[model samples]
Target: MIPIPRTLGLTPEQVDDLLTTADRAPSRHDNRPWRFHVTSRVIELYSVPERALPVADPDGREQRMACGAALFNLRLALHGHHVRPTVTFFPDRSRPGLLAVIRHGGTREPTPEQTRLLLAIPAQRFDRRPSGATAVPRNEQHGLRRAALDEGAWLHVVHDRPERALLRTLVLRAERLQTADPAFRAELATWSARSGGVPDCLPAGADGQESIEEEPLMALLTSHLTGTVAEIQVGQALQRVLLTATAAGLATTLLRQVVEVPHTREELRRLFSAARPPQAVLRIGWPGAGTPRHGGDVMTTATVP
Candidate 1:
């Protein structure tokens, strides 16, 4: 076993706590495709390609985004300890798995927003609900938008019915194509089944069609730039937005089908006249009374090898 990087200014227990929280970030099939390597003074983030789902995420975009989410959580955990994290993306092109490097920076108290998000890290979940789509307040919507902007991304809230109708068409088309693929279905099942008999399966009504009509709120995460670095930024922005929504007592789900299919994703970009490519679509709303804040098998594939 490798010894802890004591020069990084974190105790062994603190390192364990930090990594546990970081691994809690949501992923496509909860794949947790992130690995951390601690050097004398920095924490490095890596993407484990073996953990990726090639059929569902052929280009490895979602896997990279998921690692980005882990990066955000790791940053938040550092903030919780009052240590600022200096981040660098793709520091070594020769080592492609090296997604980011985080060095300990100046110590500062956590901001109110950061504290709220830190507390919300555990509450955030990839919720699945067929109904109970209450409207998100305008102020909260703006807050979510700002959360994304803070991380260098944009959130486009879909409020127009006609625009939503077009998105609905694209989503349906993508879902149909995916479901018809035997490999896709098998890949989806492999992950869903790994949830240890939880209700993580793709149910009939959860096809995201009803969401366009009754989900009350839907938003797309977009970035001005494209490629690996932009995807990492979008992932961090996605986690920040999700944590903000959770802190505000909102439930969120990913309308991933819309962006998973290549042609459908292109059509979505055209539909929105987006200057940047869309990274993810979020279905945000309020959960019903008695609804659990978190309910699913929280798996951690975060390895320190």
Candidate 2:
């Protein structure tokens, strides 16, 4: 373990670079609900409640997850700088929005694998288009799972035929319920429009009846813990898995509708044998020729190392 430091050693430019990478983290509808406060000792992460999706994520689970993803990116950037990051989740219960505090622990050289993930950061994007017929290889799938494990979370790949079918039904049912809700539709429209994505339109995979049925390489992220802190960890795990897939030249789409609906989320919990609370579901595959709905410019940005 790296020794902890009392104060963060990052300069203003370094801090800006860290936040730039953090800002690129995947979010629900690209709300970018996280904020960072730079103190003399550390960089503090907070969730912007006003930026959260009230209708789709009332409990703020997705917001916290988004923040966690940002935190993970911040950590990875620190690793690239050869600075170990020490993170404290929910440092003060009174200030509930303050999600995490990251201190400059100590110096450590970046590993080759860490460098790979760091380089993969800019290439990560949310591909709402349909994936091609190429399947994710077994070794890459295992690497994805190991990425989650490294972050203290679980990745359940729905390989069994019956389980995959049942998951598809659950996803379709949740999509129907969400599409039927005027409030949900309105909220989704607002964010989609803001993000310059298809306004008032769900992604092909969001209502992905055909994709879910045909694509058997489905997976859901889970955790043995629950509530605020656990959700944050799940977010970190989610981003790690995403970056890992990106590095391996795979495409991924989030099937969050299933977890957004309470009833379906509970059903999914049962589907996974109640081992852990499901945070996010994913459809992973090789890239296709489909046009992307949103572009991730991290690969082009000089902010990330």
Candidate 3:
């Protein structure tokens, strides 16, 4: 058996580079609820309880998913550095916050697929506009399904008219409810940067003054939601799907308005009874040529050795 590489072999600068790349993973509400512990050859991902968004992610499902996304990015970064990463999920149950432990292993050249994904990291943005173009080609859609399976999740596309109508209704209702509720509005305002005039929220320019039109084809992610554990797994899978989409040169935006409401949530679940439960509704498309408005940058903390 090969012995695990200890901390003595890896330098602080290399570990810092891994953590920095991992931090770039897209997260809900811009709440980066994760931490990193680097040894010589292993990097451990842990959850930061204080960073959890209680209102938006009460069960910490999104939080864990955010961390999982980071974990995935870490793997990619290692590949970029010409190192293969070996990862163990939930390495220690006694320490629930410890999400995964990744170690540098045998050398292998980054695959074309990995290189494509790495290059896409900066260009990918959440596209909320109606895809307008025809539904994704059947072959591409099948490819997406396989990507979801790679992460242990299922992606169901809403193709039928009745199901699409039902989803549209649920989303409209949820949007109304969320816009009406003071708490929800406040949260949105906070995240949207409307509150306190913070520069970090999605700028008015990003969404434009007009509402984003809904696309005919939408996708919902469902996973077993047995408890908080299942929710986290769903989140991880969600990140995988999003990253895979990015790699495929597609843009995605999440629509949580409908699923935020209890009634709409139930309606969504009913639409996909065979799956666990829908975690998010995603709209995918090719972003037309246009100047993207800046949405502000993510906050990060750095420690110098």
Candidate 3: the clashing residue pairs are 7-40
Per-residue C-alpha lDDT of model 3 across residues 237-262, encoded as one tens digit per residue: 66667766666555566766655566
Residue 194 lDDT (model 1): 79
lDDT of each: 0.79, 0.79, 0.63
**Residue range 68-92, candidate 2, lDDT tens digits:** 9899999999998899999998899
Question: lDDT tens string, model 1, 223-292?
Answer: 8788999898888999889888888777777767878889999999988999876888877777744565
Per model, state how many residue pairs clash: 0, 2, 1
Over 4 Å off, model 2: 1-7, 199-207, 290-305
In candidate 3, stretches whose alpha carbon ends up further than 4 angstroms from where it belongs are 1-11, 194-216, 224-229, 289-305
> What lDDT score is found at residue 241 in candidate 1?
90
Best-fitting candidate, scored by TM-score: 1
